[model samples]
Target: MTAIKAADSTDQAGVWITLRESSVPVRAILAGVLVNQLGGFLQIFLVLFLTERGFSAVQAGLALGCYGAGSFAGVLVGGAFSDRLGPRSAAFASMAGFAGLLIAVLYLRDFPLLLTAITLAGLVGRFYRPAAAALLSELTPQHRQVMIFAVYRLAINLGTTAAPLLGTLLISVSYELLFWVDAITALTYGVIALLTLPKQAKRPARPDAAGRRAGGYRAVLVDRRYVLFLLATFVQCCVYIQYVSTLPLAMKAAGLAMLWYSVAISLNGFIVITSELLVTKITQRLPIKLIVVVGFALLALGQLMYALPWGVGVFLVGTMIWTIAEIAAGPTMFSYPGRVAPDALRGRYIASQQTMFNLGAAVGPVVGVAVFRAVGAQLWLWCALATMLGLGLALLGMQEPDTALARRAAAATPVELTKDPA
Candidate 1:
């Protein structure tokens, strides 16, 4: 009995090690980081770019919203393609389409053309995400999937972290040059993706497998579980978007230094990177739903604190608290839908969720500005805090999915897992 027990423990250790060593997920994540970094640099100046082109505040917002609309569309399109043609082909197509749009932007001066270019570029550019998620899902195992996803998220933020400083220096040169540089990077990404990503794996047909169309975006939209997941996800986004859209403006209004504003946002990303590993460890002992609820509670408290009469020091303290919650909630929320999705439809389900996220992104700025104007920034923060708390309470009773369900769904037939692409 003692020898048998030793053999079982040894086998489990070997399996865990092998899961960690899988290279395919790592490569997909790396490629995604490279592309996102280049795009993020361009994004750092997106509003300024529009203003330079003579767009009014409303127009600029509309253009940005249009970009989000395109992103929403792109997820559906890319997810469908990923299911049919596989991740490699879908990712290549998304990149190529995005590159063409970027080139078109250079020649367009008309507002309509500019709007169209922005929309098209956003739609095509972000299409890589869903396909990339699908690819990562295929390569990653069930138990460690959240950790891999967290690492991918970290990569995205890390890539973007340097963008602001780079943009500030380059704006002195030419914003037009910025556009050209972004375009070049995007094209290069496509070329690398075409050259480096392996062909999709092929497997024998499974008895329970369903058609790709059955896993379409519309199907996922109507599912109650998916809808509930979307609600929780939207609240998370509402809290996070405050950092970019409102928090900076609020700080400036209070006469705080720009350096502190930068510090707050930078520290938020830093916290995320540091806490991701810690969060993964906790997920093993605590239910994911419970962790999610705690995350939301912390987020609410942080936002509410900001609304109070705090000095610059206290404001920074609140910012740190918010950062902690953001770090904990961000990856888990992103990973939740994938865990709940049907195996064959996981890509489509994820894309549908992405579409909802883009929807929130589109609405966040307009709604935030309106809230600030109508009731003051304090009210805006309080309302957001209340919403987060409300969401936490609503989600308190929801059950977490079991490990078997998540793994089986991830490994199901749409993904023909054969060799490690890493």
Candidate 2:
């Protein structure tokens, strides 16, 4: 057992060293994403802020729903922009726009105005993701995609782990300051994109392009497998979003303190940071479809864990379970669109997935809160069932990437081989 443990440690060290060899732009993008995420105050504080200002729970849910709606639209638009204007331009625009909108949010006191501001903020904030993903795909070779994305996820988790603690500190001083800090970080990311990212070279137009107009999103829509994958992703997202949308309110209703909820969230982030990279390394040889199916299963079980009658200890366990699901699923999920997409339509493919995921997020809060009010803690059981359905969908729909690639290569191979004439 001791020898086995030593071998495992050696393998982890090798993976760590491999990830450390990523290029300059990759490192810069990761740093920018980390800094930007650290200042993500909206998800953590937005609901609490609304409730403190005397808004009803339903109203806060609606506001977040609007944000999700805007996010859906933004990702679709951003994908097109990434293709047309290039990834760097798309990312810069998104981050800069997000910063401006966040500042606008700070001054808006009316519910309608605040709602509008938040929606716009979500729109601009979300645009960065598809653009960044597309950029990474462009820069990295196909074989390195999983490891690179794992590094990206690590950066995001690290930032997320710090965000709550930072929010806690900033909110104690003034909520307004939280808005300012968030905006500044976004602006900083924009600057990084502008200064460090190279301009994308223009793609020469295809000779038959004028005759063949049904490309990009139109082409992506016709891919039945990808569509099914999107359906599975939507369901998974809806189930996962409950933690942010309804869990806090549920805890409050159960007479639990806010401190406990914060601790649970922080714990979730910490688990991701500490374990994801190593776990990802170990799982790299596993079938991608199996990994995703298992992730969905874990998600279902985690949700059910919340339905148990125990206290914060049980909740923490649930958090850790879902965190493991996230670590298992996230890099594979991000890599799939890139793997399947044609070079010209990669942005649109990613955007389509993001749009579906965001739509689920938009709907999750409203549904979760309503169900929670109606069924109390039993809401979690229903969510678990929903996630189980998602798992089934994934198993049915997701193809192994290696199998697909092998088929493609086989189709392209010449029917006969001949020796060179001398």
Candidate 3:
């Protein structure tokens, strides 16, 4: 089959064809990320690791918070690095840096030392994301954008689904073994980035403006619409993260067994892996805003399902609803910022999205758990309401990629240098 035709890609076969026809570099990214995420057990185990080492629950949680803080800041730094050093180098650096830190973290004994190391580990670990994502965006043709990201998300979900198992098995034996394995996979990706990504992966650090000019993130921040979209994204992430933290608490509080909670999570992961790409085959054809809005709506509805009488049936069914929402909307959410960004600013744009996700993740547990403690299951209702606001923001914020930027870029007249000559 030739490269996938946009019109023809509505079918499942066309989806496979698209994957087959993707450039080798793109495939390399998918492979590397799969390997990297396979050992991404650190996030799944950090709290456990700390607690086992005799840290108080509050201290463990604080260490986790430090990790989140590092990751939150890392994306912005990574975005800048990707623009300056190119995606391949940025990715390699992040992987290599993270690989070193992953093992280094195992040696620290004192709580203060552990906190500092974990924070750096988190920062360095996340540094590759913007570069990797920006590279993918550049490599992919816009028409195939969402589909490719769906495949990308599939790679992630596939690894994420299994990482916990590997983590569980290894943690049973030794944290040392788990940490070692995780480090190896990260280093492997660094090698892959260097070997697979050709020199063409470098984008101009400075993208020229046809009519007017701005600098660094100032160019990105001036666009009110994009900022609004980010606000919407931040809200959506807070609600989505509830499934990870608060949902379990709610399950336990409501006199439900943890088995049902685990099953519901596993179900979501399995369905997302199996069906996200298939769903994207259709969703990719829909308007970006429409898909995002529908996703938020469905997510809200899923939370409402939890608000119903708590039971195994409710748990399974609610998970299914949100799983559908994720498959349908997630690729578009991840891909849209890159699509709308100016090429030079692509890294920053994607980094911005990642930052929101991290920020939401950090805040979600704190806020969701607090609310859950206060009003109990009523937290679900609040999340649903917040989601509506996100939906509204998304509907308002999404617009066509500005044609003027491209037109100006093509004209190739250097009008102004908004940045300093360093």
Give the per-residue lDDT of model 2 (tens digit) for 34-141. Answer: 999999888778888888878899989998888767877889988988877787898899999999988887777788999999998888888888878887766765
TM-score of every candidate: 0.79, 0.78, 0.86
Supply the global lDDT for candidate 2: 0.80
| Ten-residue region with minimum lDDT total, candidate 2 | 5-14
- For residues 121-200, write the lDDT of model 1, one tens digit per residue: 87788777877777676666555566666667767776676667766777789876766777666776666666766676
Among the numbered candidates, top TM-score falls to 3
lDDT for each of the candidates?
A: 0.67, 0.80, 0.84
lDDT per residue for candidate 3 within 35-54, as digits (tens), equals 98898977789989988888
Off by over 4 Å in 3: 1-13, 47-61, 109-113, 200-213, 402-422
Alpha-carbon deviation at 342 in model 1, angstroms? 1.7
Q: Candidate 1 local accuracy as lDDT?
A: 0.67
TM-score of candidate 3 relative to the true fold = 0.86
